[model samples]
Target: MLLVLVVLGLAAAAWARTASRGWGLAALGVVVVLAAIVLTVRPRPATRLPETGELEVGGRRVTGLVLPLRRPSGAQALGVAVLAVLFLGAAVVTFVTQRPAPPDAVFGMVLLAVFGVLFAVAALALWAASGRVPYVGLTPTHLLVFQETAQVEVPWSDLAGVAPVVARTGASPLPDAVGSWVAVRVRTGSPAASGVKLRGPASRVVTQVPGPTGTTTAALIGDVHWAVDPVLAWWTLSYYAEHPAERRELSGPAAVERVTAGDLR
Candidate 1:
């Protein structure tokens, strides 16, 4: 994650520098500070097992394990740490060597402020990533997706179809290959048979869901990218699909009741 931020930060700084060197320096400083915060505030791996629990809905049993998510790989962490040290050293050097000049001092301060903001943002991201699965989960009742601040819940009964999805990182404007993702179609119960779409990056296993009739008809879908384990997500979804009775559909006031009940558990 830090690596991604660093790359992006540098790219943005490069762009900013093309227009204004001072702004570019400020941006670089901001990126450096953000990287530092990320390195310091990341979540450690799970040291103890999560609370093994289950929720029953519609007569199906949904088991859950709250695992602690790590911030970044060890190698990635080390790389960021090293880069941070180097950047800090450079900043210090620039400050000391150029302190006599007013313009240089102002530039240094700008860089300092920029780095401060960047690190602050990185720290926030680390905190968010550590607390919970930002926007993904499998439950007996429904598939929950979090996009930014909005949350969407799709009940098993509403799931009309599922398809594979894949996303890759590259310079190509078009996706070169289909990897893993699930494109779920929900039934809106309208005359037009219209539905909503929810997609995630996951493995091919998502293509198969145990339904009343049998496993679902799997389709090879393209153009989806995921940040989490698609195979695990598939496992969770499959569990719910096989035990449809365990799921429930709640809205408005009912939704509040369901949450309250779950919290008491």
Candidate 2:
């Protein structure tokens, strides 16, 4: 997560540099600060091998890394904390400076309450993010993608295919902020009769792979959407789907690089 943020910060700085001198310098400062803090306590990657070893599923040992929705970064927590403090300070000031029975006192009180609530919510979010957040697990027989409040799991048998998804605006030539992502196509229910019809947000699904029975359901995997190395993630999912027997090779970094180049182009 820290790595991802650092990259994003650098990218932002690069863009800002082209716009103006002061904005670029300020952006560069932010990038440097984030990079310095990240070097000391860098968050782990979203994808990782299970800590408790291989999982048992349907009498078979499933081996593979679990790619969670995303990892939290210290910089985000710090930013949240600062905002919470500012909100709380503003609320206190509003309450303390209010005149009793004044025409705008009621409005001031309400504003103070709102700030207090915002402060509390931000603090709680910081706490949750600081702790261990739930994550998606990727196994030999299954792929779990965690959302805000839910998780979807697709068994290897049901997983039809995986591919890269490039985001695009409707009839717009502008590039999206998030360059690319990976989506996992899963087969749901029995085969459809006549022509296959899979329904969902068509815009989100970049491309479709023929399901096990020609008809299939497709949904985006939010977990790998913001991965540090989306290309590697796509390669991993595609590799496992194509070669399920090569589960052991999914553990090492060198092995992963051998399959899907060491860096993003």
- For TM-score, the strongest prediction is 2
Cα lDDT for residue 2, candidate 1? 51
Scored by lDDT, model 1 comes in at: 0.43
lDDT of 2 at 229: 53
Candidate 1 off by > 4 Å: 1-96, 100-116, 133-140, 146-151, 169-179, 187-229, 235-265
Tens digits of per-residue lDDT, candidate 2, 107-226, equal 544553464466457656655765654444466456655544434556767776776655542333554344344555665562212133333333334433333454354445443334
Q: Least accurate stretch of 10 residues (summed lDDT) in model 2?
A: 190-199
Give the alpha carbon lDDT tens digit for every residue of 37-104 in model 1: 56545453433222333433345666532222223344344434444443444445455545364674
TM-score for each of the candidates: 0.42, 0.53
Residue 91 of model 1, lDDT score: 48
Task: Quote the lDDT for 129 in model 1.
Answer: 43
